[model samples]
Target: MAIALSQLIAETDQLLDAARFNDYCPNGLQVEGRPYVSKIVSGVTASQALVDAAIEAEADVLLVHHGYFWKGENPCVTGMKQRRLKALLDNDISLVAYHLPLDVHAELGNNVQLAKRLGWSIEGGLEADNPRSVGLVGAPAQVQTPQELAAQLALALGREPLLIAGSQPVRRLAWCTGAAQGYIDKALAAGVDAFITGEVSEPTVHFARENDITFIAAGHHATERYGVQALGEYLARHFAIAHEFIDCANPV
Candidate 1:
């Protein structure tokens, strides 16, 4: 069964509460395509590769967490940007994106889904003051040493996390998916034994070492892969539509 593109966007906007968050990119329906959609391809980013994959899948719509026209980015459609946009326009495939909205969705968010995969119990927000903190503080199923936590991350994400050692066992931890190394301070403020995020910065090592907190840098793509898939599955189940998650890997 085909669902109207407008209807799909409306349902997603409502479900993700897209308008409520201050996001760097547009939250819903970045590009309009055919009115009805029976097939959808979802991914973490809307790169040219993902667009090509969606086309290969005969997808009518491409749903993603990262999309075009980021705030403060050069607006001129040239080079890679031109090629990507042209691909979508030529194929008449809709582009829908939700950045912060996808990350922080309590039930289907990336962090929560990652937690489910690792058997973690979410405790609270890493930033207590921010009502929509994407980073989350949580407890592991069992207390683990820094080394053990690193191994768990490696096993779960299928990649070795850059582990910054801490002083003690990790009973409680905090995590955010996709380039959230900056949230480490908030995790430190929470005084969790460990903090896990997608990307790592030079200062992250210094901070982790000084504060004696374990820091884990799981791959950004691996960490963020879940939310879009969860959202795609939900859209599929809700509308009885055909949806496939296209994984376009990025090591960074």
Candidate 2:
């Protein structure tokens, strides 16, 4: 069985609305493909390699977090952008993306998925004021040392997570999935012992050192890979479609 692109778009749109996020780009069906989709391929970013892989797999829809047409990004389809777009268009591969919405969704979000993997039960979002905040605040199923937590993350993500353990065990934790160092203050204010995100900035090192909270920089792509994968699986199960994840390694 296969779902039409229009039906998929409707499902995605409903999910985005329920998540309540201010998205960076359009959330669904960014590129059009065939009317019916049996195979859905998902990833963190819509890079050239991912596009090529999706085309090779004959994916009807390519889902991702970081799609084209970012606010400050060059609008012109040139160089890498042109190649990626051409690959999708030439193959008639529909591009479906959900950025902040995917990160903030309570059930299918990156933070929630990561928390579930690590045996954490989410208490609330890190930002109490902003209901749509991407980071989450939670307590682990059982208290574990910072080192133990880092080890768990490494095992789960298949990469060594950079840990800056402070003075205590981690019970209360805050987390955002990718390139979210700027939210350190929000996590700190939530009074979490540990804060985790992907891609630490230079200032993040200093902030973690001085803030008296443990910080972990897990790989951006690795941390984010789960949410979209979970979403793809959900789509597959519900619509009776086939789903696969195209993993593209990214250190940052």
Candidate 3:
């Protein structure tokens, strides 16, 4: 009923090909707790609220898309960080996270999962030359106006997206989940009628207008809630362990 924590981490690392990505934060086990794991709580981010939820759920491991020790973050454990880490340590719950690796994985990645939910058929990567590109180029089952696409996103994500309408109808679309407005140029180069991401910058509107491509800014947390859940389910089935996905709502 329980598997060794080291084995779980090793299997997950290989499953997501974690080491292949030069991620912003460290992947795999960020905080070690018990030697074995029987239950896992998966979420979009390892926030304080999520940590508390995991503790309440009596989880042995907290699996997340975002974890601690970012590339440029303050190394010191203090303030908010101190409290969050303290809670996990006190509860004896190991923390495991995967960033870009979770975004680009073919089956369980955020982009692919979003496409599956929205009924979009993925044609290829947004950057056709790059095998590791996180953004994807795809199309819905039917052609739709920018407004219609926005409505579909709002309905599916349970959050209304900010729409920057363009002159053309959306026949082809490009998308990258979670703060990927910066990939708009790559989307444009792909000749898609619209680009979708979790957040939009001020200049994103201008680019969409001048380039005649629609832009949609869905919520970052809303857009990326699926991958970690899928990964958790996989681990549970593979190891015969229990998994629960806890959604700690974030309006952003």
Candidate 4:
């Protein structure tokens, strides 16, 4: 039971509406491989370890949230990049990636999936002006104190979040996953009681303090591990393929 690689990629592109996004890297089918895909391994990033794991799983496709050839990364076919690409090519496994599209998809997205796991009810986009905003404003099932929220995140993500105990949830919060610390301002604009993101800068402390809002810095890898897995499961169920989520953990 398998599907054509081209068909799988095409369906994913449409499902995630990848063409609508202005992403740093290409959205779908970053590396071409065999014509058919029977097994897929999904993960947060397409690192060497993940590729090795995919090869061990006999995966025909490596689908991930992060892929190579970023907007300003060193464009050289040497060293680590060379090794990774060589391995994928040698194994004849396709690499499919979705960056911003995976984050913003209404269903099977990082934001939505994270919320589903944490029992957070999404209200709207972080940016009031843009409905397609990647960051999300939402509320947990129950209004919780900063400590309670931190505990919840820790339990759910398997990593303790860096909690700035200040404002307690008054039924609303905002969040964006994977190194979106810069979007703190956008979250503030959403007027949330707390802001949750993968990482935080020094200035984020001042902003959270000054504005009486809580801040939680959950691990980037932890926060973003769900979207690709969700996508992979969906693909597997639809196409009669095998899917496994490979977690090559990064503490960051």
Candidate 5:
């Protein structure tokens, strides 16, 4: 089955409430392609490798969590940017992406999906007062030490997370996927026993130690693999169109 490109984009934007997010990049339809879409390929990022894989998959639209024209990026379409855009244009493939919207969506968002995968039950947003808080506070099925939680993260994400152990075992936990180490302060305010995010900064270790909160830095790419896939499957089921999620592996 096939759906009009406009319809697909509209549905996705509406479902994700893309307009609500103040994101670093545009939330939907970064690149336009054919009038209709029959096969969709979703990935974490629209890197050249993923673009090549999407082309090989014969995808009419490339759906992703990360897309081009990010804020503060050079506007010039040269070098790496030129090659990626040219490939998509030559193949007539549309590029659609969602950033913060995908992270905060109640059902298909990265945060919710990560919770589902790791057996954590979400209690509330990390910022208790903010309804649209990207980070979430939660608890595992059982209380776990930093090391045990690290092991589970390693098994679930296929990458060993960098753990800064705390004195207390993790009872209440907070997590926001993909370079959300900055939210540790918010997590601390939430009074969680531990915090988890992708890509730790140098200051994060000190904060965790001083605050007595366990910190886990799971790989950015590793932790974010599920939301786009879930969105792809939902699209496939909703429109009765073919959808494939291609993981172009990245360590960071």
Candidate 6:
């Protein structure tokens, strides 16, 4: 059954509560399409391929992590941004996105979902006092070697994770689902033996090596595809809407 665009927005806002996040981009509908939505497309980013998929499916609404109007991005909307938005506008497809909110949701969040898939029992947020922390701390069923854990991550993510091995076995682990190399310090403070994030910066290599923490650089796009897919499935079942996660492969 198709839901109205307004109702979809209301449901999405209620599910994610975008107001909670201090994100780079606006968290809700960035573009308006038809008043009613039957098919909803979910993806990691609203890239050209994803937009094309949405168009091919004739989806009414496109939900994603990376949407337009990023903080500090050129506001001109003249090139790639223009083309992306133009595709949505030209196809009359609505675009809705949730950034940190999607990453931080306790159950359906990216970090939480990854933890679950890896048999990690979450203890708390990596940020401690901050409730909106995107990174998470957790324990595996038992202590595993850094190599074992890295293998698990690699198998699950379908990519060989870049591992910076520490001397000790992994007991406590912290992870963030996307490009969160900056949270290395937070993980270190949390006393986790290993820190896993999607992408790694150059400095992160040195930090992990110097700090005696195992750092894993899993593919950013690979690590994030699950949360939104799970969310789409949940929303489809709960809200009785057609949902599909259109993955646009990104190596970085």
Candidate with better TM-score, 2 vs 3: 3
Q: Which rank order by lDDT, best down to worst?
A: 3, 5, 1, 4, 6, 2
Instruction: Estimate, for each residue in 1-252, the C-alpha lDDT of model 4 and write its tens digit.
Output: 889999999999999999999889999999999999999999999999999999999999999999999999999899999999999999999999999999998999999999999999988889878988889998989989899999999999999899876745557899999888888778777778888989888988887888788889998999999999999999999998999999999997
lDDT value for model 2: 0.87
Candidate 6 wrongly placed segments (more than 4 Å):
none
The candidate maximizing lDDT is 3
Give residue 185's error in model 1 in angstroms: 1.2
Question: Which candidate model has the greater TM-score, 1 or 2?
Answer: 1
lDDT of 3: 0.94
Give one digit per residue, the lDDT tens place, for model 5 in 1-252: 799999999999999999888889999999999999999999999999999999999999999998999999999999999999999999999999999999999999999999999999999999888999889999999989889999999999999889999999899999999999999988888889999999999999999998889999999988889999999999999999999999999998
Per-residue lDDT of 27-78 in model 3, one digit per residue for the tens?
A: 9999999999999999999999999999999999999998999998899999
Please identify which of the two predictions, 1 or 4, would achieve the higher TM-score against the true structure.
Answer: 1
- Consecutive 10-residue window with the lowest summed lDDT within model 4: 163-172
CA shift of 100, model 5, Å = 0.7
Superposed model 1: Cα runs more than 4 Å off: none
lDDT of 1 by residue, 163-211 (tens): 9989989999999999999989888889899999899999999999999
Report per-prediction Cα RMSD to one decimal: 0.8, 1.4, 0.7, 1.0, 0.7, 1.1
lDDT (CA) per prediction:
0.93, 0.87, 0.94, 0.91, 0.94, 0.88
Superposed Cα deviation of residue 48, candidate 1 (Å): 0.8
How good is model 6 by TM-score? 0.96
